[model samples]
Target: MWKKTQPLSHEDIVAIYDVLLGRRPESESVIENYRRMGSAAAVVRAIGQSGEFAGRRMSSPFHHYHASFDAQEVMRRHAAPRLEPRDGHLTNFLGVVIHSKFLPGILGDRAGQVEDIPIPANWHADIAEWGAALRAVELARDSFTMAELGCGWGCWMNNTGVAARRLGLKPHLIGVEGDPGHIAFAREACASNGFAEDEVTLFHGIAAAAPGTALFPRQKTSGMEWGLEPIFNATEEERRRALAAGSHDELPMIPLDEVIGDRERLDLLHVDIQGGEADLVDSCIDVLSRRVAYMVIGTHSRQIEGRLMDSLLGAGWNLEMERPAIIRLSEGAPLTLVDGVQGWRNTAR
Candidate 1:
C-alpha cells in the first residue's frame, strides 16, 4: 500500500538515497560498498525477488563451512537440494524488499548470501501454497497477528508482516531474536521501510516461556544470509555448539505440555526452530490441542513423527499435509509441511 511518491528534485533524491545505518562498522562498509560498486540496484533487485540468494553462500571468504563441517561433507551431503516450492512461496518477496530498499544483510549474515548463512526460521512459510493460504487468510480476516520464533534478517518477517497487513488484518507482529544485534537490524530494516515499530515488536532476546519463565537453551541462529548456500561447515565452532546443545534448540527435545500455554491465541503458528518443533510439541501438547487456528510447522523429529498430526486430529483440526517434500532427503526424517492449515475456533466452549 505504499504508493511511490512523486519524483523528487535531484538534490532531494540524493538526500533520500542517503541510507545511513546506525549499527556496526561492517554494516556501514556494506552500505558504502553497495554505493561504491553501484550495487544498490542489484541489492534491491535481489531483495525484491524470491530465492534470489538461492545459491549464494552466507559467509564471505567461504570459511563459514570450514568453521564447522569438512569440505567433503559440505559438497556431498548438504549440497543436495532439500527444498521444493509450496503454497506460501513468495515469488517476488526479495523483489519487494529491494523495492523497499531495506535489505542490508539484516540477519547475522556478514554478506547477503543465502547459503553461507541459514534460512531464517520464518522462511518455512515460503512455500507457494503457504503464500496462497496467507492471501486467503488476509482476504478472510480483517486483521491478524504473525509472530516468528526466530526471525532471520527480518526479510521473511518483514515481508510477511507487510503481507498480513495487505491481507487486511491489523498486523500484530512479534519477532523474538536472541541476538540483540540481529534484533537491531530487524528494527532498523522494518522501520526504514515505512513500517512503524509498533506494528512489529522486535525483541532483543528470546521470548520468555510465559511471564516469569525463561528457556535455558544454548544456541540461537538468526537466519540466512545466503548466496553460497548448502551451508556445510564441519569445523565451525557454532556447529560444535549446535551439536553440544543437542535437541534443546537445534534438536528434538521438548514434549507437548510445555510450549503451548495459550490454546486459541495464535492464529497461525510457524515453528522452524531447526528440529525444535518436536520439543515445542512435547512441551505444549495442549497448545496443539487448542491455541493455534492455523499452523505451518517444519518437522525435524522422527520419533514424534505423527505427533503434530495426532494432536491436531485430537483437537479436531482438519489439516492436510500439503507439501510432503516428495523427494525424501532424510530416511523418513524429511521436511513435512501443512496447508489449509487451520483449526476450529470455538466460541461456545
Candidate 2:
C-alpha cells in the first residue's frame, strides 16, 4: 500500500490510474506528470476530474462508491454554490436553483425542506449524466446551445444551462416534451432560474425519426408520471383501442431535423425517450454527427444499448462514458430493472 504523505512511485501512479480510472496512463510522460504532483491525493483528485473516472463511477455496482464522488463533495471542494437555498427553493451541488414545486412526486418528502434534501445522494440524476452534460458545457467556445428530447420538466436543459452560465457563457436552451403539463413545468423552471425569454424555447410535442402523429399518455397525475414514451406508427385498430382506453392522446411528432433547426452547433443533446431512444438516435445519426457535440442518452434495455453502440460507433462518434442497463433474470428471461446511461462525443465535430 502507498502512503498518502509520500510521493507516489511510477508503479503506484500506474496502479492508481488503472484502479480509479479503469485504464493505464496514455504515455510515460503522463505518469511523470502525476509523479511531479508528488502526493497520491493530488493524483486521485486529478483522476476524479477525468471523463474515464466519471464513466467508472457511473458503471460501479456499489452505491457507496458512486456516493463518494457525489456532486455535493465535489462542489464543496472546487466550486461554491451560486445561490443559497431557501424554504421553497434549493440549489443542487452544481449550483442550479430549483423550486420545490418541481420536486413533488420526484423527490417525495425530501423536497419538503431544503435541509432535508441530501446533497451527497444521487436523488434526481446519476453521476454519469452530470459528468457528460458538464463535459459538453466545458467544450463550448463562444456560447452554449443544447436541446433535450423527451425533456420532462426541462431538467437537463435547466441544469446544463445554469452550469454554462456559471462559466460566463450565454446559454440557449431548447426542450421538447409530449406532456403539456410537463412543458409548463419546464417553462416555470426556466423562469424561476432567471433565464431570459429569448434564451429558452420549449416545444410541446414528441421527438421522433419523422414528422407525423403519435399516441402519448395524457397522464392525469403529471407529478407521478415519468418514462412515458409516445407510440408511433399505430394502426387504426390500435389507435381506436388506445383512445377508447382513455389513457393516450394523439400528439404531433416532430422530427429531429425540425428540432435541430438552424443551430450551427449544439453543445449537448440529452435524450431519455424510454425504449425509443435507440431508434430515434439511429434515424438521426447523420444529422447528429454533423451538429451535436455531445450526447447523454438514457438506455432502457440491453438491446437498445447495443443498437446505439452500433449506430454511433459506425458514425465515428466516441463513446466517452457508459453505464449499462441493470438486467435481472425474471421468470427465465432477462429484464432491465434500471435505466443505463451512455455519454457520446462527436469526434467528427
Best model number under TM-score: 2
Q: Please give the range of 10 consecutive residues that has the lowest summed lDDT in model 2.
A: 60-69
- What RMSD value applies to candidate 1? 17.2
TM-score, cand. 2: 0.76
- C-alpha positional error of residue 37 in candidate 1 after TM-score superposition, expressed in Å: 22
For model 1, the superposed segments whose C-alpha errors exceed 4 Å read 1-95, 98-129, 132-136, 207-264, 288-290, 301-305, 325-349
- Give the distance in Å from residue 241's predicted Cα in candidate 2 to where it truly belongs: 3.7
- Candidate 1 local Cα displacement, residue 231, angstroms: 20
Best candidate (score: lDDT): 2
> How do the residues 93-142 of candidate 1 rate in per-residue lDDT, one tens digit apiece?
32223211223233223222223212211222323233423432432355
Clash count of each predicted structure: 76, 0
